[model samples]
Target chain A: MNKIPALSPTVLLAVALLIYPLIFSGAFYLDVGVTFLLAAISASAWNIVGGYAGQVSVGHAMFFGLGAYAPLLCYKLYGWTPMAGIPFGIAASVALAILIGIPTFRLTGHYFSMATIAVAELIRIYFGTWDLVGAAIGLQGPATARGWWDLTFRSELPYYYIFLTVLAVLLSFTYLMERHRFGYYLRAIKVGERAARSLGVPVQQTKIRALVLSAMFTSVAGSLYSVKTGFIDPESGFGILVSVQMVIIAALGGAGRLYGPLIGALILIPLQTATNTWFGGGGTGLTFIVYGGIIVLIARYEPGGIYDLWEQISPRRWRRKHAS
Target chain B: MLLLQVIVGGLLLGAIYALFSSGLTLIWGMMNFINFAHGEFVMLGMYVSLLVVMYLGGGPAAFGFGAAFALFVLGVVVYLSLIRYVLRGPMLAQILSTFGLALLLRYTAFWIFSANFVSLPQTSLSGTINVGGILMPIPQLVAGVIAILLTIGLHLMLTCTTIGSQLLAVSEDRGAAMLMGIKPDRMQALAWGLSAGAAGIAGALMAIAYPWSPSVGETFGLTAFVVVALGGFGSVPGALFAGLIVGLIQALSAFWFGPIYKDIVVYALFVALLWLRPQGLMGKA
Candidate 1:
């Protein structure tokens, strides 16, 4: 509401996270926090392209996997600190972004996006079956690093703050992007590329720029997840299903909004956890049935997603307006 | 011996690819749309036939054809209710809606049927045909023959039948078709029904060769996409030839490199082909 002031929402949220642990000191709160951080980062990173540029990438897990691997691979093989791997991960993701985006953007729409998904799977499978990362055995995140430079922590609190910081940085970056010149160009292109071209908007460059920036931020977060989790594998990383989940999160949240991804993570991640618990370990069928049903219902009815629905009912939007 | 093995394996695999890709190619040719849920139809066909065999206690031969026929009817129902409306809409709508439908079918199977991989109830088509020191699969031969027949039948339908002409007219130009007394919407629906039915037959054939599970649709769907792209969007013969080439590439690649790399190699080829020639092998300039 305008009465509450729009900018205060984030400040209040930070206060809540910082204080919530103080009030509720249990394993449950920690579980929610950990899960929330994961979803928040993934969804927010996805928004850079899906929400802002509307590229509909179904293969974000590629960057995520690269991010996860860079740090771990460096630590294990080259004996480099995890901090140094951040730039390496970003570089790898950027290279992949260009590799995928260059040829893919030549045409248009979701074909390129869908094709990228298969590539992600290919990489995952190659890694999974290869003896390089111990194959399917999965390399466990090193537990006893000698120094803080490795980015490994003995407690969950360090990870909590790290992801919290990542979430903040991503949100701010996306917020600033939504209000900038490139942002306006992206919005214009989303309307109609040809029309935007007619209006002198550099269509090709703008799309590439959106994707590159999105990939950089997403990679940073992916690295964090790998370190936090302490292990990585094919099925857990660069699979099409993970990409689908990220997309669903972006869609469920308002696509183009600054804070929508966080809102999305709050709703769905909890639902997933509750479902898993009820079934006691990946319930056979009913969960997916409900999940698929929700996707169908949303696709049919609420293409604008839940956040857009919320905005429609807001008091500000509901105020009396001038007649047409 | 190598030549015989490659030839036999490629042909059999080609038949399965042709059957599935025919439906996809037809939809793309007329509609210029790709259904992300396409693989699900094939998966559904497999399951349906599986259930029929389980209930009726007959071999794949006795009830397989009838089950496939029943699935064809369901395909028509799907087209009527869902896929028809999206043909003329934005590309995103068709892709997303079909994806949703696919998810619906996949999860519905998961909910009802266990996910622990089940084959067709009865394997009626058993036995091998050996020729020149190379053993050929009988069921695969049946699948190939049927695939070729369906392709020919589809070709005949498109060229020789009035209904086919109506469908072609709509695809060429919607406004022009309307002027010529054709209902473009209905034609689009019919195209979807026919395509789904073709995929159903492919699925039944697939069950004879291997097995069916709920989520097995994605890999086959990806293969069909490659074939459709390679063969030229609207060309039936192109799809057939392309499917065969893909099967050979896959089989050879599986032997040359590893099975895992085969997918990557083909997709990389698809991307390169797209880059060098977007219209595809048989498409008109």
Candidate 2:
């Protein structure tokens, strides 16, 4: 069997995506595509810490919320553009991550996960009551002229391209990290933090660095999400479901792998859109029910996720032939 | 006088927290597995109580006991079917299995009952009693009393009974217990049953005072986690102590700062406490 070049498939996929808007010319399809890209970006960012460092944080919605609200609040209160607020949002998320990580990183496994949830809940409750962020009413982006400065677009085309670009950048970043010494250290920590530390891996520092990177990217996604949606609320911004979705997407695709989150987003976003369309008014949590079932089956049978499944089912002879 | 009332109210609320959390702590101690679906178990208990009252016209005692029995069976079934298998998998699988079960149970309730809130009918446990200048709701008082009694009873059972010794032996060393002719599976199933039964009773007791929907489990689940963590993951008495402390903190903070900030106070304290003592107050180091 002839081995295909690694970059060819990715480039082909990118070309296909670029021409998709031109071919489809429908807002719904563009919306779904953008959503997929956004989910992909978020999940990939999460993979840095969750997949690589082996720290499962359920409170990542806190960074997402911060990324979302910082920009919206600045726009609402200070008459600043969301573009101007993005840096501040990223900085705030990083700072908060440090504060949270300092205490939470001391604990391991489930304890750390629980602590993250608590912190996120605390922030959610605070935002729910704090009037400065409009409390539970949430904040709306100002009605502005269609321009890159404000990040508001009349058509979904620009947002689609922006999301695609962000996804590409993040994917490239993850790809680099995967082959780098930093990535190796993270994997080492994941296998055994104590052993990693004994091997002079600087376990805490490495974990924090991974988490900061994860938080920064997640915040960027959050800012983009809020600006694109033109609204931000505590529930929508920092909802536990949002955190769970990121985890699910990463896990489903194959955590720690370069293309894992993208694959996960592809599968999940379409399913989410379909379920919401079909069962939205029915008040049945069918989407979540399916998600739950998938998580169980994956965890029980194949903790390696879909990527691992793919590897197993792929032709071994082809894989070995392509190793060079 | 106002502070006294707040303190009393907090104690009552804390007792119920302890009651619900004891089961979670027991399961953790027995198997080192956290039940993410524990809140759903309590929610099911609430619905069981509601069903018994609506259909069978049972009083508080009958419905409370009914919830316990029903959820006890559920706990055992879940252990045999879901938990037992997941336990052998990775830590992520163990955590997410119950999480999946939680979503399954919660959404099933949503499908059957819809999203609307429901409350129990006025049973024998109603009204309030005034002591000094403080007015105590009778239902809360009874729930609190029952919660303390159940927690202590569980503690005593673990310390005193032959079955308890066998259960502890299995937890201590499954192979050793097997050599002693103890069935680890049966004992573990019983622990799950007891844990879930306690949650059911807690739900019934809580239903007396609080109107709830299927989503109520989220709040209870988070609270149970906090309580169990605070009390020490595997300690029944520690859960009781932590639950009361949390309830008291919540009540006092809610009174002083406002209702919304109450969670902030509890969680801040919780995080700080965990930071200082990662093993928790009573958990083995």
Among these predictions, the greatest lDDT belongs to 2
Best by DockQ: 2
Tens digit of lDDT per residue, candidate 1, span B104-198? 78878876786768876447577888876898888877877877787778878988999989989988899999999898887887887788878
Estimate the TM-score of every prediction.
0.93, 0.95
Misplaced by over 4 Å in model 1 are A1-4, A284-286, A315-324, B59-67, B73-94
lDDT score for candidate 2 against the true structure: 0.86
Give the top-scoring candidate (TM-score): 2
Per-residue lDDT value at A39 in model 1: 78
Worst 10 residues of 1 chain A by lDDT: A315-324
- The 0-to-1 C-alpha lDDT of every candidate, in the order given, reads 0.75, 0.86
- Model 2 has a DockQ score of 0.61
The window of 10 residues in a row where model 1 chain B has the poorest summed lDDT is: B87-96
